[model samples]
Target: MNTINVVIIDDEFIVSETLKSYIEEYTPNLNILSVINKPNDAKEIISKLKPDLIFLDIQMPILNGFELLKSFEEINFDIIFTTAYNNYAIEAFKVNAFDYLLKPINVNELQNTIHRYYLKKKNNPLFQYGQVKSLLEKINTPNKTERITVPEIGGLTILQTSEIICLKSDYGYTDIYCKNGSKITSSKALKHFCSLLKNHPDFYEIGKSGIINLNYISKYYNEGTIILENNIKVSVPRRSRKAFLETLQIQ
Candidate 1:
């Protein structure tokens, strides 16, 4: 029966405000933590607000919801992605995000999301925290990643996690290189993807700039440089010495 703290973020001023009003009117047990229009600002507020639920927009000018998710090193809150597009819906479910709601929002759906959020948390706070930890580990690994669901940019194509050969950070965004020798730019960070790659033994984070799957390594030499299956050599960073050796030994 305690009021749930919540925040909403959207690029559209009207949509954000409208959602805020609806929550206030329909959900009396909800406490308005804050509402923001920008993803970067939302990141800062999220650290301070620590809301139980975040209603996030998938598309925005500065940073999308996926990108904003990367900014939080630790995510202990549930998120409901609010978007007009349903293309990423299945992927959203794959990542185990709390729920998804389409734009021109439906009050009933919103209420259902909130109701589930409350019941889940109220009955099993520990379980929710465990899910958060699992999600973090799943996102931080370098290889052996599960399928990633990004908003379908072109047609209905969904990118599989196994297709990724490597991940690298560029201008703050992550680039996913596939086995077919194609690359896609993602709004999320390499760190975020790394967290999601935990269960896969084939991937390893050798350094700060890159994460590579060992299955793609063509050769490993004494000098800490590895030749990938694609014939790209990656120099292991000095700090990762102990872990790199340990991982190698295990394999």
Candidate 2:
């Protein structure tokens, strides 16, 4: 059996140590190169020692494991990510990660994950640049651009959900009002934007004509009316009013 060079990166020392011990006691032909707690510290380790595998914990202080991956130019190693139950992060992992082990790592599950690692090691085609790009886009999407890509006559316009104060219907098309004083007319109807933003936590409908991004909103008036940042006002009808307020409170 070929020795699999591995490094473990986790903020919790005990957690990393426990995993190290488990791998040593239960898994064979795996050489532990370095056990690191900090992402910055892991940089030197990674550059100096090109390990075959990395047992990465997604959430770490100063820098989470995912952030560390961005620093590396060439990711030629397989990764088994460890993360807590984060809705977005979990969704991102669905795109990548050989296998993700949830917190309070189960020895049996760990063993199973290691077994899968061996199977993948035979053809470890993980973490290509495009794959990595898509993966991070999924993870960082909600809090980042979180934009709706609208195809236009000239090219395209990306309306960042965070910057959108509200949306209004213009016949069949939708007019997106931004905090930056730019107005956009998307070919899609207001209902389409509503559906796209339905799962998105930042937007809520006001009246029949409009949807407003929650982060930009300051307060809500009755019947879908809302006072947004910079005192820009917008409103929706009574039908969506109740649902919008409830969604606001939940958000």
Candidate 3:
């Protein structure tokens, strides 16, 4: 059995310790790397150590686990949120977070989560990395040009791709803001829409989770963020900043 590296992010010291002990006692092959209390600290750990598994807590004073997860945009790790809240499970899974375990720690449930995590990691390479890549490929499929299919809450709404002001990632869905003052959520990953819309020359893949319709962009400021024609502000991730700027001339 290969050793699985793990990190625990919870404000509760005892809970972290408990899970650490449980992992050590039952899963001999699982190595407990480090337990952290701050969500921000997890970012540094993630960059440096790159732990395969993380036991994250949903509710925290500052950033919270989900925000921490969102901050990364591009995650190569598998997460198991050890939260007291159950209401956010649906939302969490939407962003591709693998599993959730409620607090007051059940050993059996923890074991089950670990088992499921391994299975998912082994089986779904698409969920881990390929899905995002596949979606990106679809976005870059088209160099530049025209209209996009705007999926609404009720149904599909076709809108000119050049009229799109900005794109935002909500959970797993993409919200498209158009020049007509209408906003619609795409029924797929932002990357999916990016792939399909990338056919339009005016579209720019701005952020890790956003694509901006450059024709509607008013100005670029504060490094990577831009103001759209509709007065909407769209952010460009540091990773995609260069490409976003370069794509501005695609038309």
Best by TM-score: 2
lDDT of 2 at 110: 87
Question: TM-score: which is higher, 1 or 3?
Answer: 1
RMSD of each: 9.5, 16.1, 14.3
lDDT of 3 by residue, 40-82 (tens): 7889988788887788875554565656766676778767777
Q: RMSD to the native, candidate 1?
A: 9.5
lDDT of 2 by residue, 24-116 (tens): 988888899999977779978977898888898765545657678888787777778875535566667775654788766778988898887
At residue 220, what lDDT does model 1 achieve? 73
Q: Which scores better on lDDT, 1 or 2?
A: 2
lDDT minimum window of 10 residues, candidate 3: 134-143
Best by lDDT: 2
Error of 3 at 203 (Å): 43
Error of 3 at 162 (Å): 47
lDDT-wise, the better of 1 and 3 is 1
- Cα deviation at 3, candidate 2, in Å, is 1.1
**Predicted candidate 1 versus true structure: per-residue lDDT over 110-180, tens digit per residue:** 78877877776778774444454444355442232245544223321246666767777777777777888
Question: Model 2, stretches more than 4 Å misplaced?
Answer: 124-130, 141-251
